[model samples]
Target: MPVDQPQPAPPVPPVLPADVELRSPRPEDAEAWSRFLVAAQRDTYGALLPAAFGDDDLAASRIAALESAFAEPGDAARRIAWRGSAVLGVASASAAPADWEVALGLVPAPASRELDRLYVHADAHGTGLGHVLFDAVVDERPHYLWLIDGNERASRFYERRGFRHLDERVSTGPSWGHIPMHRMLRG
Candidate 1:
């Protein structure tokens, strides 16, 4: 008889804290949202795209854009993760624009949706806030997103949730110091 080999334990999923709540963006949230986004981006992408984060004017412009988007969300659906009064993370999804598809050389699908943004504060990383925010926006449907080319942590998270690289790339232009990004899709 062959000896039995020990099997590895299944990976454990992170558990969201009971106090956390997810809600739609409100006008009152603009300032906190802006600060959270700046801090989160600094923690997440500062090194990968230094110039963008280092520029105060650029950061201000981005914050203004975020506030404007919150006020007039248009076709996008957004969610903000909160723990009491603190903003923990944010996410949004919207119909993939035809121009974006064309630019990426992708054949547009009628139901194609884009995961516009998903940012979790560093304090919430291990508390399952990311997963909660992700599911709240684009749970398991065919959707796509762009990520910084070398974001290993986000890549692994998306890969585990069924997203795969489409081998397509884009640039953020000079405003962002020409940071490179790759597309990922889940179908």
Candidate 2:
């Protein structure tokens, strides 16, 4: 069966429940955040992006990227969703950087922003943390993000929020055996 591609519509705001607390990433969350990052990627890709899963590769990649990003804070905002002390999800955005669009082979207009990451721990699925985290970061502004190829759940999420893809796939990055990924843009 063929799936419908994303199309433009009004942004669908996330309905975050009160218990799903939202906060800025703290210095103390480094260790937990790293673990959360790996777990989230493993679950997301193992379940969605790949034809087959490799746990070790995803773990290694997460270690490499998380360490490098948190080593020095730069122009970025990270929003964390939590239930009590456990981090449910994480989302972030930095000043639109050169080559990021190029990396994803996307060219956002000067008015757009790049949503760096939006990840929710696998266990939080269906609890709506993903929507909450997304709301905290992007919230339907003129923005673009790389969507892993074949990620139907995420595709539907953004599609519902009016994000449309550029119809180009970039075989890029280390995650999911460097899967074919594409950029989704919305204004």
Candidate 3:
């Protein structure tokens, strides 16, 4: 007979409500934003390794990329939800690369906009920030995103927010497996 180990206690629920002030991300937000994103990604997905390209150092790289992208020429925007000095979530959309479709899909065309990323702290989950962020992104640009299949929560979230499925092709990431879902968001 073997003894079983006890499971860890669940995270404490957030006292903060869903109502958060949304504003543009500032350079000052880089540190906390990087920390939040790194921890969130690690908690949600075991480890981060995209084709041996992304590792533990990926978070810093992502932060740098985000900073650069936001500062680059052309229309780019980032919204951060905040409760005082604390950052609750972030959402961003940008003009997609001309070659995005060719690289990711059988069809090749230009995308008006693409949802680059959206992340809400786990403490803030179920607090309506996700919906808020989604709405902000949609309001900023008329576009769609290609969500990888294994992310059921995200797919369901998008579906609930009015995104429609466009394809069912499978694609693989480094550490993650096949993800088969193409979705479009329309008014």
Candidate 4:
């Protein structure tokens, strides 16, 4: 089914109106990105992970995954949305893993980009950062993201934006609880 592209919102009064810059992440951003994850886990995922995973140490590891995507010379990018020194959000894509390897079987290959992780700081929630990042991915080409089921706010957000359910899968674990979900995207 063809989905109607959601319209972007006009700029409103952003909490931090300082010159917003969306650029590549650098070594200096390690601390800021770590701090951002504190808010990410607390707000987005509800602090469901262990203390070790939710702490600052995990930030470097998470950022490393994103950095690896950019490690390659060409056709890869890692963008960190910033308001001055603060890292508000991040968006990156890599060679899509095979269908079975990715969550919800989102095949990032064959002319598609997989939105591995698109997160915004809690302070910036509802400021349209998610929409902005998603638009960036969709505009790139065939793109996909797996929305876990129990995350209603996120699921609804994606649905409202035009992602449709391509599948219903369940994931279970202690640290990574069951995430029943639908896969949605834009072309």
Candidate 5:
């Protein structure tokens, strides 16, 4: 079974509440942002990969990762959707001159951007946070990102936005029981 999966939820709405604010990550936000990522991962992947949740090493790794992503004030250029003080969603992409990562062979493309990650809390799912976050780093052009195979709803959402699945796939790291994930691309 896949280790990283989100439970079923209603479709995301096209509109977001007016109070929702979209912006980039701030330096001081490291701690809250780390908590949000961990919580988000747990909410999405807990059921699929229960063992990973109990692994303190994995939890620390995730936190350290966010710290690295937010290491510099403007390093990753991460964007966030916030509702007042709480984080609603997050999105980010690497610099262009890109190469999409795959399991067997790399999906190479010149100057094609790639989505690093995009996640929205389930509570904010129907509030258009996904779309808001996605649009921050992606338009309708060519790009790709890996999606956990078990996250059908997210895969469908990517499909709705014109991302098509490639034939290749990969797995989560060793601790994840080698769950499969599909690579989706848009052009």
Candidate 6:
């Protein structure tokens, strides 16, 4: 008789902390949202960005922009993940604009949506916050997003969520240190 071989256990899915809350962006969250976004970006892409990217002026500018956006009526649907008073992550989506389709050489679809921003604080990684935030902003419809060229972690996350890369790559311009990013799409 042959001995039985050991079997490996299946991977466990991450769970969101019970206390965490996911909600729409509010005017009062502007400062927290801006700070969280900048910190998350620095943690994930500081090395790939220019020195000026970490300057106080840039942070202040981001805060101002977020404040204005939060106060204004906008097309984007945004969600912020929070744990008590702290922001844990954010995600946003909007209908793809005509200009964006033209630039990407993509045929316009009425249901096409753009995943604008999805950032999670480093502390929230592996806690399922990112997945929750993503699902909160987007659904099973066709949507697309741009991923930074070298962010392997994010690439893996998106790939596992069914996003596939396109041949097109674009520069983010001077504001983002001219970083190259590629487009990914999912239906």
Name the candidate that leads on lDDT.
6
Which segments of candidate 1 are over 4 A away from where they belong?
1-15, 50-74, 98-111
Between candidates 1 and 2, which one is better according to lDDT?
1
Best by TM-score: 6
How good is model 4 by TM-score?
Answer: 0.67
Which of candidates 1 and 3 reaches a greater lDDT? 1
Model 3: runs farther than 4 Å from truth? 1-21, 47-62, 98-110, 175-181
Report the C-alpha lDDT of model 2 over 126-156, residue by residue, as the tens digit: 7777777777777545777778888898899
Candidate achieving higher lDDT, 4 or 5: 5
Give model 1's TM-score versus the native structure: 0.75
Higher-ranked by lDDT: 2 or 4: 2
Candidate 6 to truth, TM? 0.78
What CA root-mean-square deviation does each model show from the true structure? 4.4, 8.0, 11.6, 6.5, 10.1, 4.8
| Ten contiguous residues with the weakest lDDT in model 2 | 49-58
Please write out the lDDT profile of model 5 over residues 32-136, one tens digit for every residue. Answer: 676676678778877676565535533666657656667663434478777889888878877543332434345453226677678898888866778878877
Per-candidate TM vs. native? 0.75, 0.70, 0.67, 0.67, 0.73, 0.78
Candidate 6 residue-wise lDDT, 85-148, digit = tens? 9888989898784475577565653347888789998887887888888888888788888788
Residues 73-93, candidate 4: write the lDDT tens digits. Answer: 255445678986668897655
Error of 2 at 131 (Å): 1.9
The sequence of per-residue lDDT tens digits that candidate 1 reaches over residues 99-139 is 65677565664347889779998877767888878887895
Worst 10 residues of 1 by lDDT: 49-58
lDDT, residue 12, model 4: 55
Q: In model 5, what are the clashing residue pairs, if there are any?
A: none
lDDT of 3 by residue, 27-143 (tens): 667666666665555565554334433244356776777566555625765778888777788787776643545575535422477776688888877887887776666663456
Error of 6 at 30 (Å): 1.1
lDDT-wise, the better of 4 and 6 is 6
